[model samples]
Every structure is written in C-alpha cells, then in structure tokens.
Target: MSERDDEEREFDLKWADGAEQKEPSARARMLAARWKENPPGPVPFRADPEHVGSRRRSSWVSTAVVLGCVAAVIVLLGYINFRAPY
Candidate 1:
C-alpha cells in the first residue's frame, strides 16, 4: 500500500480504540449520579393576577370590533348586489 494509505489506516485505527477506552469526565459522572437520585418534575405555568382583568377586557373589546366589522361588510355587499344593474 502507498505511504498515504498506511497513514490514513493508522489514524482510523487509533481513533477507533481511543474512543472505546474513554469514560465520562468527573463532572459528567457526578451530574448523572445526582440526576438519578433526584430527577426534575414538570414545570408549572404562572400568570400575573393584576393584569388578568385588563387582559380579559381587551380580548372582549377586540372580539366586538371584529364582529362589528364583519357585519358592516356583509351589509355593504348586500346593498351593492341589490342596486347592481343585472
């Protein structure tokens, strides 16, 4: 085999065994052990109570505006169709 081929083969073999002989570092092993001892629980949602009333009021106002706009458009279209020369 060529010299370059031999060098590539040596590199591949070195990495293959180098990885197998490795273990997790001290910090990683400690974290894994601690996680096993006390795992985390699901997070809870938190909302501010002071702004809840204002938020609800704004939502209702926005809904009323949207419905009013839709009603106006429907009436305008009906009038246009009725007055059209067909």
Candidate 2:
C-alpha cells in the first residue's frame, strides 16, 4: 500500500477502553474498506539496468560451466564404452 492509502486506512480502532480484542471482524472491515478504495493488484517492480545486466552475465557463465561438465562426462562415458574389456 502507498503512503496516501495508508493515511486513509483505519487501524487499531477502539470502541471503548479495555474492550475485548475481537480483531478478526475489525480486520475484515478494514480490508473491505481498502478494497473498495483501492482494489488489490500486482505491485510493479523495476530493477536497475546495470544490476540486471550483471546478474544476466553471471547466470550465463554458470550455465556454460554446467554444460561443459555434462559434455565432459558424456565424452568420458563414450571412451570407456569403446575400450571396455569383456
């Protein structure tokens, strides 16, 4: 929720001092009010371009390392199969 929305929200409401803490009903009412005021939706997130680019580069390097290891295993198995003594 944004700052303006926060201001409009009614929270920690008190009917009387030392009242029973039946907060479930109050929470639902507050949620209903906020829903009517501002419907729920996904919050937009924007990452810094430089940070994203750096992460992408690191991911690519890791992928290449994994593929290289897989390729080495396959080559070793092929050589072993060809030279195995029955």
Candidate 3:
C-alpha cells in the first residue's frame, strides 16, 4: 500500500535466482509400477497319506472293501449250503 512496501516486495523477488541454484534429487522417481512378488521357487514337498483328510478317505475305502468281502463270503457259503443236497 506504500512506496516502501512495494520496494521491499521487489527486493524479495530479486532473489529468484536462488531458487535455481539447487539441483533436483538424484533418488527422486516418477510413475513407479506396483508388483506382487511370487514365491521364490517350486516347493519340494508332497502330500502325506497319513494326513487327517487322507486318513479318513483311506479308512472309508478299507471299510467298504472289508464289508464287500464279508458279504461275498456269506453269499458263497449260503450257495454251497443250498447245493449240498444236490
């Protein structure tokens, strides 16, 4: 608003060369892409048959096999008994 204030403002802008004196940061980067890292390598492992789920499946299979054999034996005996009179 006064002549002295305008002079001080012009003096401040006179130091604009100071802004260009500094260099940009070397480590600064732009437009970086994001990435999700995959596992380092293939796993050297196999599924264990004794795992709980595997054990249950194996138990059912064994149970079914045993029941089938018992049924077959029972039927064989009954047929033999029926034919003994012949």
**TM-score: model 3 vs. ground truth:** 0.40
| TM-score for each of the candidates | 0.47, 0.46, 0.40
Model 3: per-residue Cα lDDT over 1-86, one tens digit each: 69999998888878664576755454432212111233345654976655769788999999999999999999999999999986
Candidates by TM-score, descending order: 1, 2, 3
Better of 1 and 2 by lDDT: 1
Better of 1 and 3 by TM-score: 1
Query: Using lDDT as the measure, which candidate wins?
Result: 1
- Weakest 10 consecutive residues, lDDT, candidate 3? 28-37
Model 1, span 4-67: residue lDDT tens: 9999999998987788567888998998999899977876586678778899999999999999
Model 3 lDDT, residue 75, Cα:
100
Q: Tens-digit lDDT track for model 2 on 1-86? A: 68766655534233343466645588899999999999999765988677899999999999999999999999999999999997
Candidate 1: Cα lDDT at 58: 99
Candidate 3: where is the Cα deviation over 4 Å?
1-50
Clashing pairs in 1: none
